[model samples]
Target: MKKTQWFDFQNFFYKPSLTSSIKPRPFTAYSFVPFSPLAMLDPTILTIGGIVLGIAIIERILERWGVIDLVDQFSKIMRFILPVTFYGALFYFFATFML
Candidate 1:
């Protein structure tokens, strides 16, 4: 046979210490940390990295086809357009759907 113990009122008021994963850590101002590929695991950063690689591949293909000037022009056009498009979509989503 098992006996049931009564819960203490003091225990009800107590809070357990949070684990590191449960609580967010504070970042230091101007703290320098060595770059690690694991730290760059954000989806947005990965997407941008993929887009840059794709652009490089396309540029190489254009050069291979004897369209060297087109490659440069395409690179210049993409360098300016990609960031604007990325940020514009980001803000549009934040404003329209998120808000």
Candidate 2:
């Protein structure tokens, strides 16, 4: 037979002992430990990293084929055209629907 002990009222009021092995730590923003890769394992960061890697690989291929100049020229034209197109679309959308 197993031994049973009665619960004591004094045990309920007792606090953690100072000589205990476990220590309390301060709260931190990140749940992961410091310098851990899990801290930077967010989906958004992973997506951005993948996009940067893809761009770098494409740039290398373009450079190897000597077609980087074409991309540079196209990017220059796009720099001017994209903002105008975006604003024109925004203005038309606002005029037609947003009032």
Candidate 3:
């Protein structure tokens, strides 16, 4: 009787070559080292946070100036602009990375 191992060590590190039928997954390039602290930071999240903070500051300033109508108008414009910009970014990411 032959004994079998539970883990298949043979195929553990198997990576398909370029000439093989199996296609490899796309890897996004990062400028910084993954192990370092900087790897924890994502620029996209930071950019969005900064934009929100800026809007908050502007809203406060407008409120102090008694320009509530202008703030309301700006928000209405942002309602349409934000979604279009977000979807455009989503499409760009899928087109650039997934395909």
Q: Over 4 Å off in model 2, which ranges?
A: 1-36, 71-99
Instruction: Locate the minimum summed-lDDT window of 10 residues in model 2.
Output: 90-99
For candidate 1, write residues 1-99 as lDDT tens digits: 899888777875685646555667897777365444454465665677687779878988999999989998998998897888678656654454421
lDDT of 2 by residue, 1-99 (tens): 999887667874685565879789997675554345454565554565575556556666777899979768656765775566556655654454421
Could you give me the TM-score of model 3 versus the true structure? 0.41
Each candidate's number of clashing pairs is: 0, 0, 0
| Candidate 1 global lDDT | 0.72
- What would you estimate as the lDDT of candidate 3? 0.68
**Pairs in clash, predicted candidate 3:** none
Measured by lDDT, the strongest candidate is 1
Cand. 1 TM to true fold: 0.41
